[model samples]
Target: MTVILLRHGVSTSNVAHTLAGRSAGIDLTDRGREQAQALVQRLGSLPIEHIVCSPLLRCQRTVAPLADKLGIDVEPDERLLEVDYGDWTGRPLGELISEPLWKVVQRHASAAVFPGGEGLAQVQFRVVSALREHDAALARKHGGEVLWVACTHGDIIKSVIADAYGMHLDLFQRIVVEPASISVVRYTPTAPFVWRVNDTGSDLSTLAPPRDPAARSGPVPGGETGNTVSTDNEGVEHPDSHTE
Candidate 1:
Protein backbone atom coordinates (compact mmCIF):
# COMPACT_ATOMS: atom_id res chain seq x y z
CA MET A 1 0.00 0.00 0.00
CA THR A 2 1.06 3.58 -0.69
CA VAL A 3 0.35 6.47 1.66
CA ILE A 4 0.81 10.05 0.59
CA LEU A 5 1.55 12.33 3.53
CA LEU A 6 0.37 15.89 2.96
CA ARG A 7 1.07 18.73 5.40
CA HIS A 8 -1.57 21.37 5.96
CA GLY A 9 -1.05 24.63 4.11
CA VAL A 10 0.25 27.80 5.72
CA SER A 11 -1.96 28.78 8.63
CA THR A 12 -2.50 32.00 10.55
CA SER A 13 -0.14 30.64 13.19
CA ASN A 14 2.36 29.90 10.47
CA VAL A 15 2.25 33.49 9.32
CA ALA A 16 2.77 34.61 12.93
CA HIS A 17 5.61 32.09 13.39
CA THR A 18 3.82 30.37 16.27
CA LEU A 19 3.46 26.71 17.17
CA ALA A 20 -0.27 26.13 16.70
CA GLY A 21 -0.05 22.74 18.41
CA ARG A 22 -3.64 21.50 18.31
CA SER A 23 -5.08 24.88 19.15
CA ALA A 24 -8.59 25.68 17.93
CA GLY A 25 -9.85 28.18 15.33
CA ILE A 26 -6.63 28.21 13.31
CA ASP A 27 -7.49 28.63 9.61
CA LEU A 28 -5.54 28.76 6.40
CA THR A 29 -4.11 32.00 5.14
CA ASP A 30 -5.02 33.30 1.66
CA ARG A 31 -1.91 31.70 0.16
CA GLY A 32 -2.81 28.51 1.90
CA ARG A 33 -6.29 28.43 0.36
CA GLU A 34 -4.65 28.80 -3.03
CA GLN A 35 -2.34 25.93 -2.27
CA ALA A 36 -5.30 23.81 -1.26
CA GLN A 37 -6.96 24.47 -4.58
CA ALA A 38 -3.75 23.60 -6.37
CA LEU A 39 -3.77 20.14 -4.87
CA VAL A 40 -6.55 19.14 -7.26
CA GLN A 41 -4.35 19.79 -10.25
CA ARG A 42 -1.31 18.28 -8.55
CA LEU A 43 -2.86 15.01 -7.41
CA GLY A 44 -6.05 14.61 -9.40
CA SER A 45 -4.53 12.11 -11.78
CA LEU A 46 -3.38 9.67 -9.11
CA PRO A 47 -5.64 6.74 -8.21
CA ILE A 48 -6.37 7.89 -4.69
CA GLU A 49 -9.02 5.63 -3.14
CA HIS A 50 -9.36 7.20 0.29
CA ILE A 51 -8.76 10.50 2.08
CA VAL A 52 -8.05 10.44 5.80
CA CYS A 53 -7.20 13.65 7.60
CA SER A 54 -6.47 15.18 10.98
CA PRO A 55 -9.55 16.51 12.71
CA LEU A 56 -8.02 19.99 12.82
CA LEU A 57 -9.72 22.60 10.65
CA ARG A 58 -6.47 23.50 8.92
CA CYS A 59 -6.03 19.96 7.68
CA GLN A 60 -9.71 19.67 6.75
CA ARG A 61 -9.50 22.81 4.66
CA THR A 62 -6.26 21.68 3.08
CA VAL A 63 -7.78 18.54 1.59
CA ALA A 64 -11.22 19.91 0.85
CA PRO A 65 -10.56 20.91 -2.72
CA LEU A 66 -9.01 17.62 -3.74
CA ALA A 67 -11.66 15.64 -1.97
CA ASP A 68 -14.34 17.56 -3.79
CA LYS A 69 -12.64 17.02 -7.08
CA LEU A 70 -12.33 13.32 -6.39
CA GLY A 71 -15.81 13.05 -4.89
CA ILE A 72 -14.44 11.29 -1.81
CA ASP A 73 -15.53 11.77 1.76
CA VAL A 74 -12.75 12.85 4.09
CA GLU A 75 -12.52 10.73 7.22
CA PRO A 76 -11.27 12.41 10.36
CA ASP A 77 -8.65 10.43 12.23
CA GLU A 78 -7.43 11.75 15.62
CA ARG A 79 -4.12 9.94 15.30
CA LEU A 80 -3.26 12.11 12.31
CA LEU A 81 -3.55 15.31 14.35
CA GLU A 82 -0.65 17.62 15.16
CA VAL A 83 1.64 17.14 18.12
CA ASP A 84 0.08 18.17 21.40
CA TYR A 85 2.50 20.89 22.52
CA GLY A 86 0.67 21.25 25.86
CA ASP A 87 1.78 24.41 27.66
CA TRP A 88 3.64 25.43 24.55
CA THR A 89 0.42 25.70 22.59
CA GLY A 90 0.02 29.08 20.89
CA ARG A 91 3.63 30.02 21.83
CA PRO A 92 5.75 31.81 19.26
CA LEU A 93 8.57 29.82 17.72
CA GLY A 94 11.13 32.44 18.70
CA GLU A 95 10.10 32.21 22.35
CA LEU A 96 10.16 28.42 22.34
CA ILE A 97 13.70 28.45 20.93
CA SER A 98 14.98 30.13 24.06
CA GLU A 99 13.68 27.32 26.27
CA PRO A 100 16.19 24.70 27.43
CA LEU A 101 14.20 21.86 25.89
CA TRP A 102 14.64 23.22 22.38
CA LYS A 103 18.10 21.69 22.09
CA VAL A 104 16.84 18.30 23.11
CA VAL A 105 14.00 18.50 20.63
CA GLN A 106 16.44 19.22 17.82
CA ARG A 107 19.24 16.86 18.72
CA HIS A 108 17.57 14.06 20.64
CA ALA A 109 13.85 14.10 19.86
CA SER A 110 13.44 10.57 21.16
CA ALA A 111 14.06 11.92 24.67
CA ALA A 112 12.23 15.22 24.30
CA VAL A 113 8.93 15.66 26.05
CA PHE A 114 6.89 18.82 26.07
CA PRO A 115 5.89 20.11 29.49
CA GLY A 116 2.24 19.14 30.19
CA GLY A 117 2.07 17.73 26.69
CA GLU A 118 2.98 14.49 24.91
CA GLY A 119 6.51 13.40 24.01
CA LEU A 120 7.98 13.33 20.51
CA ALA A 121 8.47 9.60 20.82
CA GLN A 122 4.81 9.27 21.60
CA VAL A 123 3.86 11.34 18.57
CA GLN A 124 5.93 9.10 16.30
CA PHE A 125 4.49 5.92 17.71
CA ARG A 126 0.84 6.91 17.33
CA VAL A 127 1.21 8.40 13.86
CA VAL A 128 3.14 5.41 12.55
CA SER A 129 0.75 2.96 14.08
CA ALA A 130 -2.21 4.79 12.59
CA LEU A 131 -0.63 4.79 9.15
CA ARG A 132 0.23 1.10 9.27
CA GLU A 133 -3.22 0.22 10.48
CA HIS A 134 -4.83 2.22 7.72
CA ASP A 135 -2.52 0.63 5.18
CA ALA A 136 -3.48 -2.85 6.29
CA ALA A 137 -7.18 -2.07 6.27
CA LEU A 138 -7.01 -0.52 2.80
CA ALA A 139 -5.11 -3.51 1.42
CA ARG A 140 -7.69 -5.88 2.81
CA LYS A 141 -10.59 -3.81 1.54
CA HIS A 142 -9.21 -3.45 -1.98
CA GLY A 143 -7.79 -6.97 -2.15
CA GLY A 144 -4.60 -5.47 -3.58
CA GLU A 145 -2.41 -2.39 -3.52
CA VAL A 146 -4.13 0.94 -3.06
CA LEU A 147 -3.25 4.63 -2.95
CA TRP A 148 -4.49 7.00 -0.27
CA VAL A 149 -3.86 10.41 1.26
CA ALA A 150 -3.28 11.45 4.86
CA CYS A 151 -3.56 15.19 5.38
CA THR A 152 -1.67 16.09 8.56
CA HIS A 153 0.86 18.43 10.19
CA GLY A 154 4.58 19.05 9.72
CA ASP A 155 6.12 17.22 12.66
CA ILE A 156 3.87 14.21 12.11
CA ILE A 157 4.87 13.96 8.46
CA LYS A 158 8.55 14.27 9.32
CA SER A 159 8.35 11.50 11.88
CA VAL A 160 6.54 9.23 9.42
CA ILE A 161 9.24 9.85 6.81
CA ALA A 162 11.92 9.14 9.40
CA ASP A 163 10.26 5.83 10.22
CA ALA A 164 10.01 4.95 6.53
CA TYR A 165 13.76 5.44 6.25
CA GLY A 166 14.32 3.30 9.35
CA MET A 167 16.08 6.26 10.94
CA HIS A 168 16.15 6.87 14.65
CA LEU A 169 13.61 9.37 15.95
CA ASP A 170 16.53 11.60 16.95
CA LEU A 171 17.35 12.13 13.27
CA PHE A 172 13.82 13.17 12.25
CA GLN A 173 14.79 16.82 12.43
CA ARG A 174 16.97 16.29 9.36
CA ILE A 175 13.80 15.77 7.32
CA VAL A 176 11.79 18.82 6.36
CA VAL A 177 8.05 18.81 5.54
CA GLU A 178 6.98 22.15 4.16
CA PRO A 179 3.44 23.46 4.33
CA ALA A 180 1.21 21.76 1.71
CA SER A 181 4.11 19.59 0.56
CA ILE A 182 3.48 15.93 -0.33
CA SER A 183 5.55 12.90 0.67
CA VAL A 184 4.93 9.29 -0.30
CA VAL A 185 5.71 5.89 1.22
CA ARG A 186 5.01 2.43 -0.20
CA TYR A 187 4.90 -0.43 2.29
CA THR A 188 5.83 -3.94 1.16
CA PRO A 189 6.46 -7.20 2.94
CA THR A 190 10.19 -6.56 3.04
CA ALA A 191 10.47 -2.81 3.64
CA PRO A 192 8.90 0.61 3.25
CA PHE A 193 10.07 2.66 0.27
CA VAL A 194 10.26 6.41 0.66
CA TRP A 195 9.46 7.50 -2.88
CA ARG A 196 8.96 11.24 -2.45
CA VAL A 197 9.46 13.73 0.36
CA ASN A 198 8.73 17.44 0.74
CA ASP A 199 7.61 17.56 -2.86
CA THR A 200 5.89 20.81 -3.73
CA GLY A 201 5.84 20.44 -7.52
CA SER A 202 6.68 17.51 -9.75
CA ASP A 203 5.13 15.10 -12.22
CA LEU A 204 3.37 12.84 -9.74
CA SER A 205 1.83 10.76 -12.51
CA THR A 206 4.88 8.52 -12.30
CA LEU A 207 3.51 7.28 -9.01
CA ALA A 208 0.64 5.51 -10.77
CA PRO A 209 1.11 1.79 -10.43
CA PRO A 210 1.79 -0.20 -13.56
CA ARG A 211 -1.14 -2.03 -15.10
CA ASP A 212 0.61 -5.38 -14.88
CA PRO A 213 -0.07 -7.14 -11.60
CA ALA A 214 3.14 -9.14 -11.62
CA ALA A 215 5.22 -5.98 -12.11
CA ARG A 216 4.06 -4.59 -8.79
CA SER A 217 5.93 -6.85 -6.40
CA GLY A 218 9.65 -7.43 -5.61
CA PRO A 219 12.73 -5.24 -6.06
CA VAL A 220 14.17 -4.11 -9.37
CA PRO A 221 16.99 -6.15 -10.80
CA GLY A 222 19.45 -3.23 -11.03
CA GLY A 223 18.25 -1.56 -7.82
CA GLU A 224 15.67 0.76 -9.42
CA THR A 225 17.89 2.93 -11.59
CA GLY A 226 16.11 6.20 -12.18
CA ASN A 227 15.23 9.51 -10.52
CA THR A 228 14.20 7.96 -7.19
CA VAL A 229 15.13 8.56 -3.54
CA SER A 230 15.92 5.64 -1.22
CA THR A 231 18.08 4.55 1.71
CA ASP A 232 21.61 3.14 1.53
CA ASN A 233 22.92 0.11 3.40
CA GLU A 234 26.49 1.42 3.57
CA GLY A 235 26.89 0.67 7.29
CA VAL A 236 23.85 2.87 8.00
CA GLU A 237 20.10 2.57 7.54
CA HIS A 238 19.39 6.31 7.26
CA PRO A 239 18.88 8.03 3.92
CA ASP A 240 22.16 9.00 2.30
CA SER A 241 20.73 12.20 0.80
CA HIS A 242 18.14 14.75 1.82
CA THR A 243 14.70 14.95 0.14
CA GLU A 244 13.38 18.42 -0.61
Candidate 2:
Protein backbone atom coordinates (compact mmCIF):
# COMPACT_ATOMS: atom_id res chain seq x y z
CA MET A 1 0.00 0.00 0.00
CA THR A 2 1.07 3.60 -0.51
CA VAL A 3 0.65 6.70 1.63
CA ILE A 4 0.94 9.97 -0.27
CA LEU A 5 1.63 12.98 1.93
CA LEU A 6 0.54 16.43 0.81
CA ARG A 7 1.45 19.69 2.50
CA HIS A 8 -1.28 22.28 2.76
CA GLY A 9 -1.38 25.08 0.24
CA VAL A 10 0.02 28.48 1.10
CA SER A 11 -2.04 30.22 3.78
CA THR A 12 -2.36 33.97 4.42
CA SER A 13 0.18 33.65 7.19
CA ASN A 14 2.49 31.83 4.84
CA VAL A 15 2.83 34.91 2.66
CA ALA A 16 3.56 36.98 5.74
CA HIS A 17 6.23 34.47 6.78
CA THR A 18 4.56 33.85 10.12
CA LEU A 19 4.10 30.64 12.04
CA ALA A 20 0.34 30.07 12.04
CA GLY A 21 0.61 27.06 14.27
CA ARG A 22 -2.78 26.17 15.76
CA SER A 23 -4.10 29.67 15.16
CA ALA A 24 -7.71 29.92 14.07
CA GLY A 25 -9.01 31.81 11.04
CA ILE A 26 -5.99 31.38 8.79
CA ASP A 27 -7.26 30.33 5.35
CA LEU A 28 -5.50 29.68 2.08
CA THR A 29 -4.69 32.60 -0.17
CA ASP A 30 -6.13 32.76 -3.69
CA ARG A 31 -2.91 31.22 -5.00
CA GLY A 32 -3.30 28.51 -2.42
CA ARG A 33 -6.74 27.69 -3.79
CA GLU A 34 -5.30 27.57 -7.29
CA GLN A 35 -2.60 25.22 -6.08
CA ALA A 36 -5.22 22.98 -4.49
CA GLN A 37 -7.10 22.81 -7.75
CA ALA A 38 -3.86 22.06 -9.58
CA LEU A 39 -3.33 19.16 -7.20
CA VAL A 40 -6.54 17.62 -8.53
CA GLN A 41 -5.01 17.68 -11.99
CA ARG A 42 -1.74 16.26 -10.71
CA LEU A 43 -3.33 13.27 -8.99
CA GLY A 44 -6.69 12.91 -10.72
CA SER A 45 -5.78 9.66 -12.45
CA LEU A 46 -4.79 7.64 -9.41
CA PRO A 47 -7.28 5.30 -7.78
CA ILE A 48 -7.18 6.99 -4.42
CA GLU A 49 -9.40 4.98 -2.09
CA HIS A 50 -8.97 6.99 1.14
CA ILE A 51 -8.29 10.57 2.18
CA VAL A 52 -7.05 11.85 5.54
CA CYS A 53 -6.37 15.42 6.65
CA SER A 54 -5.40 17.58 9.57
CA PRO A 55 -8.05 19.50 11.53
CA LEU A 56 -6.48 22.87 10.72
CA LEU A 57 -8.47 25.05 8.36
CA ARG A 58 -5.62 25.26 5.84
CA CYS A 59 -5.27 21.48 5.52
CA GLN A 60 -9.04 21.05 5.36
CA ARG A 61 -9.24 23.59 2.58
CA THR A 62 -6.24 22.11 0.76
CA VAL A 63 -7.80 18.65 0.52
CA ALA A 64 -11.33 19.85 -0.21
CA PRO A 65 -10.91 20.02 -3.97
CA LEU A 66 -9.46 16.53 -4.36
CA ALA A 67 -11.96 14.98 -1.96
CA ASP A 68 -14.90 16.52 -3.81
CA LYS A 69 -13.57 15.35 -7.16
CA LEU A 70 -12.95 11.81 -5.89
CA GLY A 71 -16.31 11.67 -4.06
CA ILE A 72 -14.41 10.66 -0.94
CA ASP A 73 -15.03 12.20 2.46
CA VAL A 74 -11.78 13.28 4.11
CA GLU A 75 -11.29 11.87 7.59
CA PRO A 76 -9.86 14.55 9.91
CA ASP A 77 -7.00 13.14 11.91
CA GLU A 78 -5.69 15.37 14.72
CA ARG A 79 -2.38 13.57 14.65
CA LEU A 80 -1.69 15.27 11.33
CA LEU A 81 -2.19 18.79 12.72
CA GLU A 82 0.53 21.43 12.46
CA VAL A 83 3.01 21.65 15.28
CA ASP A 84 1.62 23.69 18.16
CA TYR A 85 3.99 26.66 18.14
CA GLY A 86 2.53 27.71 21.50
CA ASP A 87 3.48 31.25 22.36
CA TRP A 88 5.33 31.39 19.09
CA THR A 89 2.12 31.01 17.15
CA GLY A 90 1.40 33.92 14.83
CA ARG A 91 4.91 35.29 15.19
CA PRO A 92 6.85 36.21 12.11
CA LEU A 93 9.37 33.57 11.01
CA GLY A 94 12.00 36.25 10.57
CA GLU A 95 11.62 37.29 14.20
CA LEU A 96 11.51 33.76 15.60
CA ILE A 97 14.75 32.83 13.88
CA SER A 98 16.54 35.13 16.30
CA GLU A 99 15.26 33.34 19.37
CA PRO A 100 17.44 30.82 21.20
CA LEU A 101 14.85 28.09 20.95
CA TRP A 102 14.98 28.35 17.20
CA LYS A 103 18.56 27.11 17.23
CA VAL A 104 17.52 24.24 19.47
CA VAL A 105 14.71 23.40 17.11
CA GLN A 106 17.14 23.25 14.22
CA ARG A 107 19.98 21.46 15.94
CA HIS A 108 18.28 19.42 18.66
CA ALA A 109 14.59 19.18 17.94
CA SER A 110 14.02 16.03 19.99
CA ALA A 111 14.88 18.01 23.10
CA ALA A 112 13.02 21.17 22.15
CA VAL A 113 9.46 21.73 23.34
CA PHE A 114 7.12 24.54 22.53
CA PRO A 115 7.02 27.09 25.30
CA GLY A 116 3.54 25.99 26.28
CA GLY A 117 2.80 23.08 23.98
CA GLU A 118 4.01 19.78 22.58
CA GLY A 119 7.52 18.56 21.80
CA LEU A 120 8.77 17.52 18.37
CA ALA A 121 9.32 13.97 19.61
CA GLN A 122 5.74 13.79 20.83
CA VAL A 123 4.40 15.05 17.51
CA GLN A 124 6.45 12.50 15.58
CA PHE A 125 5.31 9.59 17.72
CA ARG A 126 1.58 10.29 17.39
CA VAL A 127 1.66 11.20 13.69
CA VAL A 128 3.72 8.15 12.68
CA SER A 129 1.58 5.87 14.84
CA ALA A 130 -1.60 7.25 13.32
CA LEU A 131 -0.24 6.65 9.81
CA ARG A 132 0.85 3.06 10.52
CA GLU A 133 -2.40 2.09 12.16
CA HIS A 134 -4.47 3.70 9.44
CA ASP A 135 -2.38 2.22 6.62
CA ALA A 136 -2.73 -1.34 7.93
CA ALA A 137 -6.47 -1.03 8.43
CA LEU A 138 -7.04 0.56 5.03
CA ALA A 139 -5.01 -2.10 3.22
CA ARG A 140 -6.97 -4.86 4.95
CA LYS A 141 -10.34 -3.20 4.38
CA HIS A 142 -9.67 -2.61 0.72
CA GLY A 143 -8.36 -6.16 0.27
CA GLY A 144 -4.68 -6.25 -0.76
CA GLU A 145 -2.98 -2.99 -1.82
CA VAL A 146 -4.41 0.53 -1.53
CA LEU A 147 -3.57 4.14 -2.36
CA TRP A 148 -4.39 6.89 0.13
CA VAL A 149 -3.70 10.58 0.55
CA ALA A 150 -2.73 12.34 3.77
CA CYS A 151 -3.16 16.12 3.71
CA THR A 152 -1.04 17.64 6.43
CA HIS A 153 1.56 20.29 7.35
CA GLY A 154 5.23 20.57 6.39
CA ASP A 155 6.69 19.65 9.76
CA ILE A 156 4.32 16.75 10.15
CA ILE A 157 5.28 15.38 6.77
CA LYS A 158 8.98 15.85 7.44
CA SER A 159 8.63 14.04 10.75
CA VAL A 160 7.11 11.04 9.00
CA ILE A 161 9.92 11.04 6.44
CA ALA A 162 12.46 11.14 9.22
CA ASP A 163 10.81 8.18 10.91
CA ALA A 164 10.74 6.18 7.68
CA TYR A 165 14.43 6.93 7.13
CA GLY A 166 15.14 5.85 10.70
CA MET A 167 16.85 9.16 11.34
CA HIS A 168 16.91 10.76 14.75
CA LEU A 169 14.18 13.32 15.50
CA ASP A 170 16.74 16.13 15.57
CA LEU A 171 17.70 15.39 11.98
CA PHE A 172 14.18 15.87 10.66
CA GLN A 173 14.90 19.49 9.89
CA ARG A 174 17.14 18.36 7.09
CA ILE A 175 14.09 17.26 5.15
CA VAL A 176 12.00 19.90 3.43
CA VAL A 177 8.31 19.65 2.58
CA GLU A 178 7.27 22.59 0.47
CA PRO A 179 3.75 23.94 0.55
CA ALA A 180 1.47 22.06 -1.85
CA SER A 181 4.16 19.48 -2.48
CA ILE A 182 3.65 15.69 -2.54
CA SER A 183 5.71 12.95 -0.86
CA VAL A 184 5.10 9.21 -0.95
CA VAL A 185 5.90 6.17 1.20
CA ARG A 186 5.21 2.46 0.75
CA TYR A 187 5.31 0.01 3.61
CA THR A 188 5.70 -3.70 3.09
CA PRO A 189 6.05 -6.19 5.94
CA THR A 190 9.79 -5.81 6.14
CA ALA A 191 10.68 -2.11 5.85
CA PRO A 192 9.34 1.23 4.72
CA PHE A 193 10.31 2.67 1.34
CA VAL A 194 10.21 6.39 0.63
CA TRP A 195 9.25 6.80 -2.99
CA ARG A 196 9.25 10.56 -3.23
CA VAL A 197 9.80 13.59 -1.05
CA ASN A 198 8.71 17.17 -1.63
CA ASP A 199 7.87 16.73 -5.29
CA THR A 200 6.01 19.83 -6.50
CA GLY A 201 5.33 18.63 -10.04
CA SER A 202 5.44 15.38 -11.98
CA ASP A 203 3.30 12.95 -13.87
CA LEU A 204 1.64 10.61 -11.34
CA SER A 205 0.04 8.24 -13.84
CA THR A 206 2.72 5.67 -13.18
CA LEU A 207 0.77 4.71 -10.05
CA ALA A 208 -2.42 3.73 -11.80
CA PRO A 209 -4.00 0.31 -12.54
CA PRO A 210 -3.36 -1.94 -9.60
CA ARG A 211 -1.03 -4.86 -10.08
CA ASP A 212 -2.41 -8.37 -10.56
CA PRO A 213 -2.46 -10.30 -7.28
CA ALA A 214 -1.55 -13.53 -9.04
CA ALA A 215 1.79 -12.01 -10.06
CA ARG A 216 2.83 -11.05 -6.53
CA SER A 217 4.44 -13.63 -4.27
CA GLY A 218 4.74 -11.48 -1.12
CA PRO A 219 2.52 -11.52 1.98
CA VAL A 220 -1.15 -11.43 1.35
CA PRO A 221 -3.03 -8.61 3.13
CA GLY A 222 -0.69 -5.95 4.78
CA GLY A 223 1.08 -5.45 8.07
CA GLU A 224 3.99 -3.47 9.54
CA THR A 225 6.44 -6.25 8.89
CA GLY A 226 5.00 -8.01 5.84
CA ASN A 227 7.38 -9.85 3.54
CA THR A 228 8.96 -7.90 0.68
CA VAL A 229 7.80 -8.94 -2.78
CA SER A 230 10.59 -8.79 -5.35
CA THR A 231 9.35 -7.88 -8.83
CA ASP A 232 12.69 -6.83 -10.28
CA ASN A 233 13.47 -9.80 -12.52
CA GLU A 234 9.98 -9.70 -14.04
CA GLY A 235 10.36 -5.97 -14.91
CA VAL A 236 7.11 -5.24 -13.08
CA GLU A 237 6.73 -1.66 -11.85
CA HIS A 238 5.67 -1.57 -8.24
CA PRO A 239 2.82 0.83 -7.54
CA ASP A 240 5.10 2.17 -4.81
CA SER A 241 7.92 2.41 -7.35
CA HIS A 242 8.52 6.15 -7.25
CA THR A 243 11.08 6.99 -4.53
CA GLU A 244 13.20 9.85 -3.14
Query: What's the lDDT for all of these models?
Result: 0.84, 0.79
Candidate 2 least-lDDT 10 residues: 235-244
- Per-residue lDDT tens digits for candidate 2, residues 148-241, read 9999988889899999988999898888777788888877687777767877777666444247643233334553223332211122111110
Candidate of highest lDDT: 1
- List the candidate 1 regions with Cα displacement exceeding 4 Å: 213-215, 218-221, 225-244
Collision count for each candidate, in order: 0, 5
Q: Please list the residue runs of candidate 2 whose C-alpha ends up more than 4 Å from where it truly belongs after superposition.
A: 209-244
TM-score of every candidate relative to the true structure = 0.90, 0.86
Q: Which lDDT value does model 2 have at 80? A: 88
lDDT for model 1: 0.84
